[model samples]
Target chain A: MQTLSFQFSAGQPAQGRALVGCVGSGDLEVMLEPGTSGTLAIEVVTSVNGSDARWQQLFQRMFSEQQMPALNISIHDFGATPGVVRLRLEQAMEALADD
Target chain B: MNDRLDQTRQQHYQAHDLLWGFAPEHLPLNAPAWVVEALQVEPPVVVRRAQGTAGTIAVGVRGKTRDQRFACWMPRSAVSHSVQPEQLIEPGLAQAHRDWPLFKALALLAEPLDQSGLRWGVTGSLGFQLASGIEVIHPASDLDLLLRTPQPISREQAKAWLELIAQAPARVDVQLQCPAGAVALAEWATSRSQVLLKTQVEPLLVDDPWAVEHVAP
Candidate 1:
């Protein structure tokens, strides 16, 4: 598995934690938890190895585009397509927002 | 013989007898032969559904490629054993209550369903992790559930149940198992014209849950 971490300084910390999706075939799960630090941290563990650059680019694009708060977002991936990953991330964030 | 077998058709089996297998179509490994070899080396795939016939039963297998699910007929004689989902989950939940805070929380959240008289079982990563002692669950794993009900669930009732689960720390995916078939609570909540119902025979997009039936091959 490949692990990647990122930090963003866009939005304020979310009120609570939330999660979405399951780590199954062509799918990925995302978890957003309250972060003690002021930074928004994202850590992705994926089965697809040697695609660090591609993943980094994707994460950069997502974080840059979205107004995510200061929370720790962790993803467990099982070779999910980019579309699925993005949907899960958005759902997780939406859940967190609702919380 | 048909009557006796019909009685056993949809009956749930104990977890010890069941051997989880991967679907031939989705087997990720390049070598299909290796999977066949592994099946010989591993336990024989057990029957998931007893179709009340001489040759076959609906067998459960996971997709190798994507998270697609597969349940199809296989010769009953080929199965070495059967497994119960409830048996695998209850022990794990009990153990987790003593140690894991997250699981403890989930247990508490699930209490209402038990009180509601719904037969429920956990099935996703948490279930797999607890049953196999595998490290599948992370800090953020969703509490996937299977709820068995003898009768159809109303849309309003489904929403109410979902509201109860939404209070949990993690997201919950509940599949309501009615006599006709099992449908995801989330999908059912949409109140769509048709919902995907997974039955012992096969999955179908059915509007009326009661009218759906699984015919043995």
Candidate 2:
């Protein structure tokens, strides 16, 4: 029962190059759409089944460093490692489109 | 149940039976002693107290508030119970067992949804136990429910849920009045529309499609 949510606003994209990305072993999915809401909503539900504090720390740091807009992101993890989560989140953020 | 009670408690049980009569379903098998303890107080100021002697008390309060109204019979033979402390019916607590079958239906129908972050609460008139200019014209009258959820619901799903609730077996009868069905939920979503009253039989839906607003900010 762990949840991670964050909001971000990335400036308009000049061209389409998959605003978000996906990074997982044998299972990766990303949703890219025009941003209507000012802030992007990111939700991640993972089955990594570990300490909640670690998840939150990694998620917050990733979100703060990236600071991308025009995207809402989510990730469902099944034992996906930190490197994998970071990769998937970046892909998702990049795939997003500007409205 | 009566066969197990002591003589004194038995007399009290008989007294209650004489006053409230018998409802096998409604009778609390183990009447929470707290209810009796609470009743010993001013018993939450009632909204509409019964007028005549021995009239069953029907009090109304809001779900968010603690105010309780008691509708009880006051016969000349016995003195009204004195108030007690440690049990204060704060304002806004709604109780509606005496007037409408809606509350009864809610009590019977509500079951927690799994892992959906959805919770159901009763607000407005039924939740408040006050008439929102609505009348209970039938013994099978339906009451309104406030459905708070994280995911968007399709019109088909909403209707199906209503049908499920209507078909459930219980002490009270229920009829569902979904505003989305009347006006078309998809069409409403396209226009960013909120629910509006169409007629006496219909209820409205407001801000239901979006996930952000669905969950509390």
Off by over 4 Å in 1: A1-99, B1-17, B20-81, B89-105, B213-217
Per-chain TM-score (chain B), model 2: 0.31
Candidate 2: stretches off by over 4 Å: A1-3, A9-28, A93-99, B1-217
Window of ten residues with lowest summed lDDT in model 2 chain B:
B13-22
Error of 2 at B37 (Å): 48
- Over the stretch B2-87, how does candidate 1's per-residue lDDT look in tens digits? 76564464354422134444335423445335345434434233344334344455554432322233344555444445454455
* Model 2 lDDT tens row, B22-42: 122222455443344443322
Per-candidate DockQ vs. reference = 0.04, 0.01
- The C-alpha TM-scores of every prediction are 0.52, 0.24
The CA-based lDDT of model 1 is what?
A: 0.60
lDDT of 1 at A23: 36
lDDT of 1 by residue, A17-63 (tens): 87666533345668888875568888988877666777777888888
Candidate 1: Cα lDDT at B143: 72
